[model samples]
Target: MTQTLLPATSTESSSRPVVAVTGADGFIGSHLTEELVHAGYRVRAMAIYTSQGSYGWLDHVAPEVMQHVEVQLGDVRDAGSVRALMRGAQTVYHLAALIAIPYSYVAPRSYVETNITGTLNVLEAARDLGTARVVHTSTSEVYGTARTVPIHESHPLQGQSPYSATKIGADKLAESYFLSFGLPVVTLRPFNTYGPRQSARAVIPTIISQVAAGQRVIRLGDLRPTRDFNFVADTARAFRAVGEAGPEVLGRTLNAGSGREITVGDTVKLIGQVMGADLRVEQEDIRLRPEGSEVMRLLADHSELQALTGWAPQLTLEEGLRRTATWFTDPANLARYRVGEYTI
Candidate 1:
């Protein structure tokens, strides 16, 4: 029997929602879950089921936050499990997916299963359960190498790699569900989101971990590529804003970004400045993505979201980097990652 959960709307006056987050164990998902909880929401977290019962990065968080959450072990790929988890919940943030582009090359089928089909399960559950709002997650990679500066939601989606292709498929499916079934859903396309709890698989964490551990030579690839990075808190706030926006912003995809772009090379130098370390960056051939697969540039057009919700990122790049460096420097936190070899 499924327990009855309150609608997110019913709890609005309390500055909270009885919300559920899929992929609450992963980086961005974990952070979003925490944000929702901190906002006074009754959060039920859906972590991927495993024999090890690992909560992923969520395990590293302060225990106080973890104590308040109701943990439901399930996999998004399983339609029945997803439906059960959505029981009585009003708002759903679907962030569970296989996201490594490099790994997708070896396991394209897993990408399709988790990214597309898994999203399908969440949408179906939300549609049937009458969830008040569903915020679907999308990545900047879906836009591919941008043909224009500051890419907007209107820009054509180019599937440059199998990973992006699957996400495009997932985003379109979410749109179709919203239009065809009247399922209240909003698509959130986030530029690179970085902060504490991010894994070494991501470039931000990879760079921070290597630099913090006293690496005399930092290994990197394709430093010329520019990326727009939004702090995880800002990204999480965007999700909350979409939920609070109600029906006015339904069935639309909005970008969450700082509206600023910087090259990877420049980011490294800035981090060095923040960390007060003088280190040489060396190009590693193994770290480079295939020519066609790399997204050479990404700058976000956040005007749409800003005009609608009146929210903007508050964290400066330096402050964000300093916080991230601090998290990685702590031996307790840094041990979560193996600094010797590359993750993805």
Candidate 2:
């Protein structure tokens, strides 16, 4: 049986065309959803279905921001659900996925289904539904480690972990749809994205949450690895830019990043600097990725995206980290995380 989810609000009342976003309840997804709404676009925000009536990160979205949004409930893994969520949408930003690398190692099949098969469902639905545009989210992890200093779109894809492997498959599937079926899909590969509402599982959040909870020693793993981090707001803007870009971007993959890199150790120290804390570090084995699975470095060459959409990263790493740390300082927000626990 097909579940037909109509927009909860009437777009006919406004000139804005309705856009749908899968994973609209997660970190970057929620940020994108709110940004879309603020940008005066009508948004059909699809949160994963739950019996408890929760909307994940969206549950915390300001009531004013959600007024322009039509909240739909569905799973991206279900073809029927994906199709229903996408029908009548002019543009779709598909960000839903099982994203934890460590978790991917534990349950590879789940990653395959949710990331690969789920992406296939979106592409097929977009093709069938005649969706005007589809911005399929990709990640820097697909490049594994930096084979080159500044990785370009042409960089060879290496699946260093189950998470990245499935994403690679998903990206190829998106590319196939464009070549084979003429789906207007653009892949936006964002580097490490960090900001408010990011979960404890992420490194930035892990460091900050511990500090916010008054821990003097930060526990971490693989401090040698570096990442090209982008703030969630900047990443969200990049999505809109690609979604609104002309057909020149069709079937192309663009990188969304700061074009700068920082090692984990330096990043931790920066966070402490922003928080005015004198910090000690403890490297925990449990927090470490398997030797071969670790991605040692990532620096994005985002020139293509800038040349195409005139989009450049707005917030510096220090500024973004400061904002994120400030948010985590709220007792309510800080309480949501398990400060000292190592999240797999």
| Whole-model Cα lDDT of every candidate shown, in order | 0.85, 0.91
Worst 10 residues of 1 by lDDT: 1-10
**Index of the highest-TM-score prediction:** 2
Candidate 2 C-alpha lDDT tens digits along 1-344: 11223343554426677899999999999999978877778889889878899999999987767767778898898999999889999999999999999999899999999999999999989988899999999999999988887999999999999999999999999999999988899999999999999988999999999999999899988899999999999999999999999999999999999989899999988988999999999999999999999999999999999999999999999899988988999999988888889787
User: Residue-pair clashes per candidate, as listed?
Assistant: 0, 0
lDDT of 1 at 53: 84
Q: Candidate 1, overall lDDT? A: 0.85
- RMSD of every candidate to native, in Å, equals 4.9, 4.7
lDDT of 1 by residue, 213-263 (tens): 888578888899999988888888898888778577898999989888999
